[model samples]
Target: MSAPQHPTETASTAEATSGAVLSPVPDDVDTAPTELPDADPDSADAVVEPVDATGGADGAGGTDALLVTEGDVAGDYLERLLDILDVDGDIDLDVEGDRASVAIVGAELQDLVGSDGSVLEALQELTRLAVAQSTGVRSRLMLDISGFRAKRRADLTSLAGEAARRVAASGQPERLAAMNPFERKVVHDVVAGITGVHSESDGEEPNRRVVVLPDR
Candidate 1:
């Protein structure tokens, strides 16, 4: 038998009390970058005081501000990460619904994704922690590299669609291979969208998976 997998080490580390701030950015289909004038650190530092807009006693004002600030902090953090790894990329930020979203687009970032995106998941949790520490707000930020996940989601969605069709035709529950939470979520979503099909997650972390069932 294959050895069992463990729960995400970073998931347990998140300080649950901190709130996650997400500000959705309007979609811009173009992923290309436009060059800007070089940054002047001295002038830049003098212009703004970095404060966690997500922190403090502003009450209602803090909510929206916190969302935007989380994006800024996350962008800076991702930039530093790229620098340290000697990778080149453009960072894009947006807040959609209730989550802050960040995407890194570059040609040379495959290493960051790792096999099956295990490394990306770890990096995302760590980045969220960094944002939380800076803004004093827990962030459930979603990070994407080279659109690897976007493509993966599309593929999974198609696979789920096929599985759901087969299950409806065969009238049997589909037991799929084990998948990470993100992948399972994609499958569940695709299957759930169709008529007379239902999906649920079964098992536990790491080994946890989704099972698609025919409607009764």
Candidate 2:
């Protein structure tokens, strides 16, 4: 069967449909291979990171400049996709840290955002594939729809802090409910910053969960 049109489509999405997996990991947060802290929206650092070739069901290597190339390719692909779906939205591009970030804004994006932003994640993966196909290199193009990702990051940061506190007080690792790669990364980033607490993934994909560990 064909994959759904959402951004967070599975490893099978590109592998089944295009047979090219971009990120070195099973997914790139769905684009980046390794998860890095998100750049502050108020900050203008290049925040894009390429998919790590060592991390995917199938991985490909790419250069640093390739990150910007991903942004351009994804911008064009998303522009065309919106036209096809008859959605009205504007595309904004940025290079923060070492990654390509693209946002779809200035329109009604609730449906695209979907329940808990699942649709947005699927769409982002598709956009990354588009970039990979165009550049003939794996693309870890980060896609944001209607600012959902920004809001999510803010929420995750808070959630992680709370989880860390619980672990520190109890002196027992607290296991978070299962989360997707992107969500897990958000938690990992926050947990990593908390003194005396660390986080790691434990389990297989889809059911993979994060555990916040306190320094013993």
Candidate 3:
């Protein structure tokens, strides 16, 4: 994957409490550039595990309750952020499957999305931290601004489908560019639905990519 694009403006870390002002980053959050590890041509196949957006197992009543709390906490936290930035946006919160899903919809919020969503990723981690600070548990809340992630998901789904078809026809493996956990999961899911092919992850964080393999 490419290096994280840092925002021009910075903010000091603050408490995640109500009315707390959070910077684009928190002091504890790591913004270091993630270097792509070298690829091992002979590496074993490692299936990319499905990511649980809720950060918990499915079908537990307590998990559902916690997800609701996560949404509430994250919504409040994001609202405060928009207020601070003087940006007008609507905060939509929901419990999707086992995870808390929050979306910010409005005009002129592309800056929050940043280059290739680096800024949005930073904000998401910070929001999760905020939720954890309040709930005393780690959060797996997913955040989106201006529908950037939605569009990206559609594009990735199409790309994975095309790659799967090519691999199945050629009976050869195709290595995709490194992707974040979210992007990898999208590709994995799409590939899983297709016949005659499968997908696995290789390399390390920020460099880990999906490999489409034709089933022998």
Q: Among these predicted structures, which one has the highest TM-score? A: 3
TM-score of every model versus the real structure: 0.69, 0.70, 0.73
Span of ten consecutive residues with least summed lDDT in model 2: 8-17
- Scored by lDDT, model 3 comes in at 0.65
RMSD of 3: 14.2
Assess candidate 2 and give its lDDT. Answer: 0.61
Off-target runs (Cα >4 Å) in candidate 2 are 1-64
Tens digit per residue, CA lDDT, model 1, 1-216: 111221111111011112211111123422121111111122211122333532644454555467667778878888888888888888877765445677777788878887767678878878888987887666766777777667666666666788778777876666565666556656666776787767665556655555666677
Candidate 2, residue 34: Cα displacement in angstroms equals 14
Over 21-46, each residue of candidate 2 has an lDDT whose tens digit, in order, gives 12222321322113334412222122
- Please identify model 3 stretches exceeding 4 Å from their true place: 1-59
Top-down TM-score ranking: 3, 2, 1
The lDDT for every candidate, in the order shown, is 0.60, 0.61, 0.65
**Which candidate would rank higher by lDDT, 1 or 3?**
3
- The candidate scoring highest on lDDT is 3
Measured with C-alpha atoms, the lDDT of residue 177 in candidate 3 is: 69
